[model samples]
Target chain A: MARVVFTANLHRHIDCPLQTAPGRSVRAVLEHVFAAQPRLRSYILDDQDRVRKHVAIYVNGERITDRERLSDWIDDDDELFVFQALSGG
Target chain B: MSDRLLVGTKKGLFELRRNHADWSIAASHFLGDPISMLLADPRDGTLYAAEALGHFGVKLQRSRDDGKSWQEIPAPAFPKSDTDGLSVSYLFCLETAGADRPGWLWCGTIPGALFLSKDHGESWTLNQALWDLPERKDWMGGGFDDAGVASICVDPRNSTQVTIGVSTGGVWRSGDDGASWHAASEGMHAEYYPPPRNHAPEVQDIHRLVQCPAAPDSLWVQHHNGVFRSTDGARSWQEVTTIRPAKFGFAAAVHPHDPDTAWFVPGVKDECRLPVDARLAVARTRDGARSFEVLTKGLPQQHAYDLVYRHALSVDATGTRLAMGSTTGHLWITEDGGDAWSLEAGHMPPISCVRFG
Candidate 1:
């Protein structure tokens, strides 16, 4: 099982509370979480099922590289953090 | 039904209730969200708000209890495009099919796409017939990169017959419930485009469109070139060349019960999208487009630089009340048709649209 947490800013619009789901990869973990909060998937991923340009996902202090596939492996004790990248002046 | 106004703005959604002789803000929902469009279904009193988040993309929220509470639903999005760099910039229009077709809704989005939802706002599917049209390849955006569907008119007499106005793609009609479409910009002109190209079928830029309920076949359009009216369900358009103040504006409000009666807020032109001499007024036409009367009582007569968007001007079903919101965050309403007006709200976020229900 892996723990997933959404940023406070994202939580303002959606209730993406701490979620624990069983999965071996980031994509599977996200799929499990999205099943519970379906609306959150749109805010994180675009129509092409790819991570949004401004959205960032990290697994245990390391950022995921596969934005399209989201195939990064994770362990049962891993923690995933999803937050929007801050930009603009 | 109680009189209420749903105002979508750059920051949030504001609800205004008619209080006897005056209007008051009842409540504000979706605080700090850019509401691109809003629709209040008279069939079920359901309220739909389209929010365009800068960081997260588009979102749709629905309220069944007259906007007291809202539930986020699936937002309309384009199918994964492997060739075209397509993305929904924002939802530009939200419309119901008709009284005969309950729970049926139509949504127009940027990048030029149409979506239909048979279950109200719960789900939506892209209308591929309009998407796969050959003219879509030539449809370019007016201000942005890609064109957008800004207005939709569903024929009350026949739900299957519908018309849509694209920003730079001209008007299209679907007689088989969006299964197929054909360009309906026969007599519309595009003075902004170069010669020959200006006469092209799919090159006319439309700012807004209004259909007369009294005559379903009659439709009025505020084109980028001029004001036009179609007597045969948008099959052909005739320019209303008599409209004062250059006939260049985005908003058009038609009378609910009279096909000949309509209103417009004319600006200078494309280069100067403001009232002539900075004087604000609402032009009303009682005899179709034969003539127009400029109404300025209680409106700014000098130094008023306001630009009304396409959906910002609306007339209620009763054909008596008219409301408009400007890009400068000023709202005005006319309870007695267009004879007089009063400022209802000011200093708020830039208004995206105003709907009276």
Candidate 2:
């Protein structure tokens, strides 16, 4: 079981989800996140399930650009952050 | 049944609310022909409307205590002193700073006019810096006279730092309580339209402006050409999402408290098609404008042409009420944002515009 933190710009409080999984990687963690929050799946992934453009996912302070292998190996105490990339003026 | 829909149409202003399990016209008048935009105040529950036609010109009408009573608060026309000021043809948009200030209304008009009202729906003062700014001389015309002042965004936390988008002219910012102004269109597109330069550069016409309250520097702008995102206020923008086949439409609304969540309706560009294949749908970006998904649950099936104008989209206090009115005299509401929409009211004149209370 791994502890995951979920945060968005709109809310004042943070949400944390706990998932128990055997596979270890960013992809596995995301699959778990999406399975738990279906509405969040579309927001985080494109039609092909690739991380959509303008989205940035980070694990333990380091940004992860690869969406296909989002399930990259993770240790027990790693922190993950998923957020939208802003661009309009 | 308590919630009502107010619509501005080519004929006049009309209000539709439920009475005895049936939707009925609460009020309809041709006070100012071709009523363009409608804004309902949540503070006092008054409906404020903008006229797009006739010599009556950009008048602000309000209804106190719901739609039971109505009064017109002679909003100001362009002062004669500024010979270069835009002529009052239409009022495109009106926004309340917040629920904190009872009567403060900011109105956007045709010919690129911005008016501020400190006294509820009563008198209005013009933001001169916007018209007198050094950038106006460079603005030619985008051909669509109604395109002016389509974007009016008030900072959630700070009302003083207001932003307005002027088509072809670029986005303008009023930081010091509208006393002075500066061009915030640095990263915005400005498609120059002239006999020789007809098609302005891409990303020029910004139809919508929204800010992340948590990240005020982050703004989202929907253009006639494309969508852009800026993390540093209006300093710079980068193209994030461009879904071909549908590029035009007005009004992009951000969740009242959640800056990361926003939505916009898209229609075919230039060719003048209804919003997104003539379907009643909304495209939402839960993570800001970085990406978007078409929200079609509970929408019409036959693909009706329901064009929702610039002033028609709004998100309520809890961000639970996502209400939008269409030019086709239809009003839709979703308690769960744009994921699914239910027809709150329907069947009236071609609705010129709609707003929320």
Candidate 3:
């Protein structure tokens, strides 16, 4: 299971706490996270189900490369961090 | 009369209360957020405010006990398809479907799509019939980067008879709810285009479309170029060339009881979007569009550069109480029609919409 964490700024709009989920890719990890907190989906992705331009997801301190498909590979012991791009807010 | 006013602004949603002599700010909600549209539902006094956040996209909030508290509701979204993927950039308008259909709501959104919420904003469905029309392919952006639903006029006589105005696209009418629809008319002319192409309905840019509740057949529009009046239910529109000051404006409010009486905020055209002579005045006509009377009493007459948006001017059910908000962050109200408008608030933020309840 990979550890997932969201920025503290998003806590006011939707609750997102540190958690561990089993996934091998960024897309699967987000799907596991959104499956529990449904309302958080739109805030992270747009209508096309792609990552919002202003939001960034990092895998163990490395920025995810693919925003459209979010196919960046993840390891079981890796850490995922979601942050709202400063330029957007 | 509705003494409560809801103003959507660039920063937040401001609620104001009317006093014996003037209006004053009572409460503020969604501070530091851009409120795009508001609806004070007269059916059951339900208040709705739409916030367009730059970072997190659009959000909808509803308050039943005035402005005391709000509940987050799901905003309308476009369905995903491989052929064409569209998203709602912003909510342009929120309108009620007459008093009879108390729970029904009509929403106009950017990308020129319409959505219907039967459960009072709790859930919304995109109007697919409207998007499927062939005329939509010709739709273009007016002032926005893409085409948007500028105004929605639901027929008072029948809730199903809806007439929608798109910013760059022409007007569309639906008779049997959302089952079928058609281009309202080929009557309006587009000065931006050349020759016969200017007369095409798809090229028309309608700024705002408003209909008189008492006389549902009478419709008035503040077009991109000028003013137009339609007495035959938008089947045909006759250009009104007699408006004083200037015919270019973005907002128009019709009296609830009188079809002939209407109010419009006029300013200079095209290149210059400021008020004429840098003075703010509302043009009122009691006998249709034959003539207009500039109402400047209690309003700034010099060094004022306020421009009202499409949904910023609203007339309450009494027809005497009217509220107007401007792009320059000013709010005004009139209790005796449009004769004298008293300044309520200023220096707040740019206003997008106003609703009285």
Each model's backbone clash number: 0, 23, 0
DockQ of each two-chain model:
0.55, 0.01, 0.67
Off by over 4 Å in 1: A1-3, A20-25, A58-65, A71-79, A87-89, B81-85
Q: Which model, 1 or 3, shows the larger lDDT?
A: 1
Regions more than 4 Å wrong, model 2? A1-89, B16-33, B43-46, B53-55, B81-86, B97-102, B140-143, B190-203, B212-215, B242-245, B275-280, B301-303
Candidate 1 on B1-357: residue-level lDDT in tens?
A: 238998999889999998888898899998888999999898998999999887788999999988888988888887886764466778999999888989999999998999999998788899999989998888888866789999999988888989999999999999999999999999987988888888787898888988997898889999887899999888889999888866999999888789999999999988989989999988889998899999998889999999898899989988888889998999999888889999999887889899986
What order do you get sorting by DockQ, best first?
Answer: 3, 1, 2
Clashing pairs in 1: none
Model 2 scores a TM of 0.68
How well is each residue in B1-357 modelled by candidate 3, as lDDT tens digits? 987898899989998987787688999998888899998887998999988777777889999998799988999988876854877878888999777888899999998999999999989999999989898988899888888888888887898899989998988899999789988755789888888689888888989999998998899989889999999999899999889799999999999999999999999997888789999989999999889999899888899989999899999998998999998899999889988888889887999999987
Best by lDDT: 1
lDDT of candidates 1 onward, in order: 0.89, 0.66, 0.88
Q: Model 1 compared with the native: what TM-score?
A: 0.93
